[model samples]
Each structure stands twice: as structure tokens, then as C-alpha cells.
Target: MLTKKSLIGLTALGALALNAVPAMAQVTAGSQEVHAYVGETFGDDLTDRRISGRTPELDDDVTYGLRYGYNFTDAWGLELSLGQTNSAVTGLPGRDIDLDLTTFDVDAVYHFNPSGRFVPYVVAGLGYASADLDRPIIGAVNGGSVRIGDDNGFTANAGVGAKYFVTDKVSLRLDARYRYLDKVVDRFDDSLNTFETTFGVGFHF
Candidate 1:
């Protein structure tokens, strides 16, 4: 039986398939893609610890970014993505701690139908994530800016998405991914996870 996550992926891919239309030019080898996208990120707990005075949560927020990809073959490609989010650090009373996050990833992609107008693909990658804390914890001894994740804790992700050529050189894209974070905070478990979905326009060259 398909798990819940699998079902969700299938549903998203199905929608892309339904939008398939003949394209003026296919995603041929040596093709490059530049896309500008906006999406939502569902927040995840930064840590399992609920200690008093230790703030350990991130809130859901909107994200925007750009992606660049180069196809080496009709079926294989690599992409570099950069995104940013303005979200709050929850679990703090009286008010939330606002923070800004910057994320980068390099993913390898496999297209199911590079020749089709609606092309669905699977992606996996490793990357880095960092956050800028607005300020230090309100009441901590020897306080300093809190680090968002372990210095060595690397970020990894896997997801599925699709693209539909709207015109000869312009295309519409949809993507959804789950990111597994390294330790979110010092001394806390790094098993944090976040969900993201985006829609964008792509320019093929």
C-alpha cells in the first residue's frame, strides 16, 4: 500500500500529467533552465527539548527563490537553488522571535518524460541552511545569538515536481519537497523536518 507521503506525491504528479500539451521545443540535451518561484514552507520543530527558557521552534512562512539547471542528457540534469524565508521562532511567550533563513541546494534530477510538455521529475540533493537570529535569548546567562543548526549538521532533501511548457520558451513549474535538517539547536536532536511546495515560471534556453 502507498504511504501517505507517497500518495501526496502521486496526486501532485497526476495534476501535472493532466496539464500536458505539445510543446514548441522539447527539453533537449545542453538545455539550460532558469526559474523564479514562490512557495510556502510548513514549519517544523527545531528541537525535542521543551526546557523552560530554551526557545526551540520555527513557524510556517512564505519562501521565494531562483533555480538554475543544466541538462546533460534528455533524462538527467543538475540544479542549483537558492531560497529565503521570513519566519518566527515560536515557543517564546509574550512575543515570537523573528528570524530570516537562507537555504541553498544542489540537486540531481531525473525526468520521466523530457519530450512531453508536462514533465515530471524526482530530485535528491544535499545542501546548507542558516538563520539570522534577530537577537539573543531574552534571559540567558552569558547569552549570545542562538545558532540555528549544528555546524556539521548538513541538510538533505528529496522531492518530486513537474513542468509544463506554456509556450515555446516559457513554462510553468510545480514542486514539492521534504527537507531533513541536521540538529536544529545545540544539544538538541537534529531530526527536524520541513515541507515545501512551490509554483514558478521557467525559461528554457
Candidate 2:
């Protein structure tokens, strides 16, 4: 014979029991990860209508970075990364512009299968890019060497990746992402786009 008060108490106990069930994940909450990676940034173009009345195309180049992340839950985490790249802008007459690039990013990551030895994930974030372009430009319209500040601004990116664990603490990682540069160089196009892919070793602790 259950009274009204007894029914309410039973329901509360059931809720408590459900809350005690643990999430199924190989990496427990509060774990931290570090990765060292090397990769490439593919080519892109700048609408430098002032350079030669033609757009300048940038060439593919090497990139390297380090990443640090913290897992808030079995399936969710926060990440920060730092990297650098060296590339060149070609198709200009008589000379090419050398570009030096630096990047920093903050991201949120979601793991789909934290309990598996192979985990696939997605990441999306905001970033900053600083670009240095070195050349004496022959601005067709301006007819002079263009003087402008270094290109530096905000960027947004999203990507998918996978990790294969060889041991509980070590894994191999592969990731690819598309990034949008929001007019870092005010003198150029309103936005620039690029793609990058990386592979590396990671450790969880």
C-alpha cells in the first residue's frame, strides 16, 4: 500500500540511481592531452586588384604546431594551439612576395566514441592570423610601391579528425580543417579561405 508521500520518495530514489551510472569512455574526465604536429597549408589567392590588376596566388607550404587540451567530460574538451608557416605569393612580374604566417586558436572538441580505441571527433573554433608580406609591389593602378600594415585579424575554422590509440596514453592523430580569414589585410579582399591537414603524435595523461 503506497501512500502519496511514499510514491514521491520512490521517484526521487530512482532518479538518484540513474545519476550514479558512469559514462563509458576510455579517457576519463579531467584528463589532459598534448600533441606535436606537422602539416601543410594549401594554396589560396588574394584579390590584390592593386598589385597587377590580377589576383596573386599563394603556394602550398609547411606548417608545424603544438596543441594542449583538457577533457571536461568523456566526450567534450577544450583545446588551444600555436603554429607557424612559410609560403610565397607568385605570378607577380620580376619578383615574388615571401609570406611569413603565425596562428593561434582556441577550440571546442566533441568525441563521438570515447570508449573505443579509435575515436573520431569534430572541432570548431576561432583563431588569429598574422601575415607578413615582403616585396616591392608594382601596383598597376597606384603605380608605386604599396605600403601597408602587416595582415592580422580573426579567423573561424571547423574540421573533423580521428585518433588511433596504440596504448592508453599514446595515440596517432590526423586532422583536416577549412579556415576563413576575415579580411586580415584591409587592403585585400574582404575574406580569404584556406585548407590545412596535419598528422602527428599525441599523449593523454
Candidate 3:
């Protein structure tokens, strides 16, 4: 026969064991999820120009946008992002140009360790970019109006990022990426390239 004290102790132990089973199940279920993030991108422009005797310069600018991703497996996922960047040009007198660049991209990401609190990933993607260039240029030979057309092109991007999970539902992220853009034609042939670094927060569901 069980004594009163022994009965109470056994009952408490059984209750504790029963509670622990759900906690373990929760941990296993938390590893696989879909997440969405919104963040701002801050970095220098890595604009490369292949024009002879001309160098490309990019102004400091910031872009803000949203990203949505879906995890297919424990370690692989795909993400799509949309954002815009504004660039200004200097060094050429009366040739200061402000460009608006909009981007849409989809990438495949491989997470290093999805079960860990801190996860790192590498990503590569193909995308399209559209740029509208606005600037004033003074004619060298004869003073005349030379309006430059809007420049649009296809772009490609690749990058790596690390995320720190604050909880099962939230994380902090940092990323660095390189983008190559198509050519732009004006009084001078110009093209834009970019190296972007972004830091932001994410939510998992």
C-alpha cells in the first residue's frame, strides 16, 4: 500500500514527466518554418564602368524593402525581395546624376544549421533591375539639350548572411551582396554595379 507522502511524490513526478513530453515536441516542431522579414539596406555603391578614360562613382544611399521566404526542408529555402536605391554622381561638372534603381530578386538559400539558435546561410539569385537616370549635362561644343533616356536592365546577385535567433519566432540578420547591372547610354556610356550590406530583423511562423 502507498503512504500519503509517497502518493503525492509519485503524482508530482508523473505530472512533471507528462509536461516535459510536450516541450520536447515543441522543440522538434520549431525547427521547420516559413519566415518573413522587412529591413533597410545601407552600403556603398560598387559601380563599375567600362568606359575609357571615365571612372564610375556612386553616392551613399539607403534602401528599404520587404522579403518573404519559405523553407522547403530543414536546411534549404527560397526568398524574394523588392527594394529601391538612389545613387548620385559627382566629379563631372554639371554632370551630377541622380539615379533610382529598383530591384526584384529570388534566391535559393542553404542554411548551415537550422536547429541551432544562430544560423548562417549563403544565397545566389537571378533578378531584374530597372534604373531611371536624371541629370543635367552642359554641351561641350555647342550648348544644346541632350536628354538622356531611362536605363533599364537585367541584374544578377549573390550574397551571404548570418542570423541570430532571439526566440523561436524572431531573429536578427546581417547580409552582404554584390549586384551586376546592365549598361546605360547617354552622352557618356555608363553602367552601375553595387555592393550592398543590410541588417534587419526577421519573424518565423
Candidate 4:
């Protein structure tokens, strides 16, 4: 007596129920933890438009950040990070542009070995960024100021990091991550892409 649509819906519901049974059985109390890290970051700036008759140089710089995480289970967790990049522009006469980039990111991490002391994981996140540009000579020449505002973007990151457990409540961490940030700057009839590599330490509690 059931229509085809009804039959398909019932079958899908059955599959979902079967898949969720194990997840419900594996739930545990969440662990709240905080981490701080400092690392060197190399950045590449890809711009479609030329500035002052030259392409914007990719900046290799240092970056540092802090993060906090909540582990809902042995295999799954959520994390947030705040990081910054320092860079400059070249080839402009007394025209130096200092770029300060800030990012707020939230990601989900999945550990490969849930029960091992050395846990390696992969992560992906969404990020929001702000770029502050300081141009001393450009402002002096034009009697005006130029600044890049906060922009919304998506970031995809994949890295291998090992967690060495020092104690039940603490761990030592080392990570190498490569982040691809969406194009945020599209001024002067051009678009720019930003990328960063970071290494740092973290403590888990």
C-alpha cells in the first residue's frame, strides 16, 4: 500500500538508524582542554592584478597561535585557533605596506589511533580573517589612508601531528600544517590567494 517515495524514505531511515546505534553507545563525558603554541609560518600571496607595475611578493613570515578544544570522545573533538601573520610589500619607493593578518578558526579532528599514546590526526576548519595594511608613504602621497577590513573565508588544512602523552592530563605536541585560505583581497581589479605553513607545540588537559 506504500508509494515508491514512502518506501525510499523508510529505507533511508532504517540505514541511518543502523549507523547511529554504535555512535550512541560510544558517548562519553567531554574533556575540556587548552593549548598554546608558537611557530614559524611561510606565506605565499597570489594576486591576479599587478600593483605599482609589479606583482605582490609572497611573504615568508612567522606565525603563532593559541587553541582550545573539547573532546567529546576518543576519536572526535572540536578546536579553535587564533593566529597572525606578519609581512610586507617590496619595490615601492618609501612605500612600505605592513600586512597583519588575523584568523579565527574552528575545526573537527579525527584521530587515527584512538587508544595509542602517540595519536595522529587530520583536521579541517572554517575561518574568518582580518588584514590590516599600514602604508606610511602612500598615505603621505595621497593624503589618505588604505586598510583591508575583516573578511569571511573558508580554510582547508591537512597535517600530521603527534601527541606524546606525558601524563593522563597532559601531552606534548608537534604539528606541521598547510592551510589554503580563500581569496579575500580583490582590490585594484585583482584577487589574491593566501597560504600558510605553521609548526607549534600544544598541551592537552
Candidate 5:
């Protein structure tokens, strides 16, 4: 029997599959490519100990990463990527904290316009992440500061993106993704979901 979370994940994937069918018709057999890129990651509002029905938020910041992929067919490709972000913690009163996040993922992508100048794709992946929260300023008496221990867990992400090929070997890529994290950290019992958008240039070989 499929659980609630499993059902939701499948539904989202099905929608993307439908959109990629038309694009599959245009793909050439045995087409392969490799790419490298850099981008930013943004985390969503996180709830630690809820205070008066409110949750604290983490500030969004720049992130950089690289990706490598191979296309077995025009519509189907596999991608592995790594990225990291250092973001300051906000919304906590009288606290100075910084959170560092790292991600490694393997995704399957479906390109909708593989032969055209503009190619649109949807990607879904399983990822591993490590998160660390540290106090930036040292103080003997930090007032009620919420301290989160370093932890790691599994994650899943889904996103839509586009690539515009400038030449046979170069392209501009733009992506927007939503990442759902399990065990956001060791302390938090619930999951964390974040949104990230990035722009980068890719080189294919």
C-alpha cells in the first residue's frame, strides 16, 4: 500500500512524465553530454521551538555547485550534483548563528525539447545532506540562544529548468527546485522543505 507521502511524490512525478512525452519524440538515439555549473541555494522558513505560534527563519544566501550528466536518449538523462551554502540564521532574537548546508544528489531528468535551442526539463532526485549550526560570536552568556546540533539526513527534490544552447558545447541553464528534507537535523522531529533557484552556464562535451 502506498503511504500518503509516497502518493504525493508519485503524483508530482507523473505530471512531469506527461509533459516530457512530446519532447521524447524529438530525441536522438545515443545522445550524450557532460556539463558543469554553479548556482545558489535558498532555504525555507524553519520552525525550531515555536514561540507564540511563530517560527524562526533562515536567511537565503549564495551557493555554488557543479553537475555532470549523460544522456542515454534525447528525453532521458542521469545527473549527479554537489552544492553548498552558508546562510545566516535569522528571526531568533538576540542570537548570532550561521548555518552551513551541503548537498549531494543523483537525479533523473526528462528533457522536453532536446533538439531545440531552448530545452525544458523536469528533474527528481534523492540527496544526502549535512547541516551545521554554529554561534558566530563567542559569549559567556548567550541569552536563550537556540542551538542546533550538527546532523545529516536524506532528502528529495523536484524542479523544472531550462537550458538555452548557445553553441554545440555551451549553454545557459536556469532552474527552480523545491527540496524536502527528512530529519532536517537531529533535533527537529519534522521534515523541512525549501525552495531554491539558480542560474548558471554549462559546458557540454
Candidate 6:
């Protein structure tokens, strides 16, 4: 009832039909998203080996950040962010160790309610950060007042956030995140850590 050519053609047609089923079932959340935001970093601290042979503490103050992301599907996406903060070395009263920090990160994100007006997401990422010490307390150990030596390291963070869509193209976003980084000075045993909160507007296309 069938020729060889007909059998081959039918088999090819069946394969194409099967492939089309999956293609038709696939759904995408959005192609891309960009956001600009300003926020504050809190609960940030550092420990460093001091000239007195004891570890001294530093505290981070206000912070600001911006982020951009791409979505592969309704539930999966990737993001990149940049942030900056100011800090001061504590426990050393007279000596000023003004520090400014900058960080860059890339993350994988998941949206639990991608199709809803309000979407909740979780994000985790790997990053790099640098601390600029404005005034060097140890001149011989560090070269200049803006000591960048031993102030750069690997970083990591994780957080939760939500987006409330006001329209098809715009949304309001709020997030809180925490990060951990390697110590600036080798002798310090504790790693640096920070917690931050942010609110911003996002656009999707």
C-alpha cells in the first residue's frame, strides 16, 4: 500500500509535526529588561590587620546601584548589576581611612510568577569588588593614599525581589540583597559582607 519514497516522506512529516508541538508549546516571558535605581547599603563591615598588630574594623555607609537583565523564558533570566558605597575605618579615632567601594556582578534569575501583574523572583550571582582606601595609614606597606593594593577580590550575592507591573512596558521593583567578599588584607580572618535594599522602575520589551 506504500512506496519507499512515500514512507520516507511520511516519516519526515511525522518528525516535523512532533517538533512543531514543542515549538508551539513554548512560551517566553519577555525578551529583555532594563532598570535604573538608587538605594542604600547597610550592615556592611570589614576587618583588617592593623599596624598595632590587631585587626581593626571598617563600616560601610550609603550606597547606590543600577541593573540590567535578559530573559530566556518565562521563568529564566540573567542579570548584571553595578553598585558603589562609601565607608570609614573605625576604632582608629584620629587616623582617617576613608574608603569607597565599587562592585560588579552577573546573575541567574528565576521568576515564579512571570505572567502575573506582580512577579516575585530570586537571584544569585558571582561578582568582583574593589575597595579604595583614601588615606593610607601604612605608607611603607601600601604605596599611596588611595591604596588599591589588596583591596580587590571575588564576590558573591543572593537575594529576593518583586516587580509590580503598572503596564505592559513598565513596572515598579523592590529588592533586598546580601553579598560576601574576600578580605582586602590577607591577615584578616573574617570576610567582608553587605546588605542592601533598593527600589526602582523597570522597562520590558
Model 2 regions more than 4 Å off: 1-25, 48-50, 142-145, 184-186
lDDT of each: 0.75, 0.74, 0.59, 0.56, 0.67, 0.66
lDDT, model 5, position 123: 96
State which candidate, 1 or 6, has the greater TM-score. Answer: 1
Model 1 C-alpha lDDT per residue in residues 37-81, reported as the tens digit of each score = 777888877666543565467788877788999999999999999
Q: Per-residue lDDT for 1-205 in model 3, tens only?
A: 2223433543454344334322111112224443333233333322343222334355656654567777777678878887666656543435667867688888887888777866888988988777666754333323433333455567778889987666555566778888766644344445555677765555567
Highest TM-score among the candidates is held by which one?
A: 2
Candidate with more favorable, higher lDDT: 2 or 3: 2
- Tens-place lDDT per residue, model 2, 59-176, is 6887777899999998999999997777777666557788777889999999888879789999999989888888533455456565433578888889999976666776667899
TM-score of 5: 0.74
Q: Summarize candidate 6's per-residue lDDT along 44-159 as a digit string, tens digits.
A: 33554443443346564666567888888899999998877666665553575777778899999998868777789999999898877776544222422322233688889999
Candidate of highest lDDT: 1
Residue ranges of candidate 5 with Cα displaced over 4 Å: 1-38, 51-54, 136-147
TM-score of candidate 3 against the unseen true structure: 0.68
lDDT value for model 3: 0.59
RMSD of every candidate to native, in Å, equals 7.8, 16.8, 15.0, 16.7, 11.4, 17.4
lDDT of 3 at 164: 64
Pairs that collide in candidate 5 are: none
Clashing pairs in 6: none
**For candidate 5, lDDT tens digit of each residue in 51-125?**
333455566776656788788887898989887777766665556478878889999999996888789999999
Candidate 2, poorest ten consecutive residues by summed lDDT: 1-10
Q: Candidate order by TM-score, highest to lowest?
A: 2, 1, 5, 6, 4, 3
* Ten contiguous residues minimizing lDDT sum, candidate 3: 21-30
The C-alpha TM-scores of every prediction are 0.79, 0.80, 0.68, 0.69, 0.74, 0.73
